[model samples]
Target: MRVEQQPGFVLHARPYRETSLLVECLTRDHGRIGVVARGVRNERARLQRAQLEPFQRLELDLLLKGELATLRGAEPSGAVMRLTGDAGLAGLYLNELVVRLTGRQDPNPDLFAHYERTLRRMAGGEPLAWTLRRFERDMLDALGYALQLDIDANSGEPLDPSIRYVYDPESGASPGRPGDPHGLRGADLLALAEDRSPDVAGLSSLRRMMRQVIAFHLGGGELRAWRVLR
Candidate 1:
């Protein structure tokens, strides 16, 4: 089937055979898609680049068969969002996450919308930590692993800002267990839960909590872009 003028972004791309490019794209309606952009590297082509680069929204035409699709045409769908410094790195990290978590041809339009909004937020110079935390929470929520940050897991009550709680990926937040070395303040978790920007300590706690949740799902596979941010 020939899919025409789909909204998407190039999540990743690389050189293909002598004159083509292998491109991985996240489409608004089609989820993560891999396309063979044939002849993109050839001198006669207008794109000139071997592959469409990351961080740009695009309208794409794809020829679908089975696993890999043939790229018929591609053009910028909207203005390219220019992200620099931490924002740029963050964008790469997001792309990697979507690439890893989503399957080809699965429609995840809401997640696609979330991705676009996050890029806009990042490009607008929103604080990296705050932006990252929110994105992590939303991404996890979309994937059905959303953290129970607003309430207690054991008591089933709204979290009090002053209390401390242990976070279990499967069980959500609960009053700190005896001998628990690591826990988050209800203030901090509630701030995260409400999507409020956190203080330095709270942000740190959020980072740790998000890392734990994401790592649990990933089964300890490392996030390479995360290391670059360090």
Candidate 2:
């Protein structure tokens, strides 16, 4: 299939053969895809190679045949996102999540939009913890693992903010044993569920909870980006 000027972002790229690159991209309509960028590593293709970096929106021309699409051309489509320090690491984490969780050619417009918005927000200096947690929630939902936040898994009742709950990765939240230090506050869980502004403590709670959920869904393998961001 031939695609023209497909809007996308490079999620990862590695050297292929002598002068080519194997690029993974997330596109608006095509989800995650692998493409072969032939000869982009050569000195003459420096300009084209530069356009394949992460966090920059691009218009890609592709020729899809077998397993890999041929990257016919690429051009920046918007202002390049220049994130630094922790923000930069967060951006990388986002890319890694997309690469690992999304299936090739499975179109998810909402996920794509969430990813773009999160990157933009991170680049604009939004609080990292909140921004990343929101994206993680959206990403999980898009992938069909929506968090069960409103009800207690054990009792099947709405959450009580004053109570503490133990979250089971597959079963959701249930009331915790009294004074269990590891239990997360129902208030913080509710805040995350409602997308309300969470205080520092709430943000911390949500972060730990999200990490557990994401890691569980990833089948126990920790994300390299998460390790780096720590």
* Model 1 per-residue lDDT tens digits across residues 75-157: 88777789987788899999988887777888888888889899989888889899889988898887777788898888899
Q: What TM-score quantifies how close candidate 1 is to the native fold?
A: 0.93
Best by the lDDT measure: 2
Please give the lDDT score at residue 131 for candidate 2.
Answer: 95
Error (Å) of candidate 1 at residue 221 is 1.5
Q: Model 1 scores what on Cα lDDT?
A: 0.85
For all predicted structures, in order, the TM-scores are 0.93, 0.96
Cα distance off (Å), candidate 2, residue 4: 0.9
Residue-pair clashes per prediction, in order, are 0, 0
What are the per-residue Cα lDDT tens digits for candidate 2 across 1-230? 99999999999999999999999999999889999999988989744688898999999999988778999889899898899999988889999998888889998988999999999999899899999999999999998999998799988999999998988889999999997766888998888899986789778778888888888888887899877877
Q: Determine which window of 10 residues in candidate 2 has minimal summed lDDT.
A: 43-52
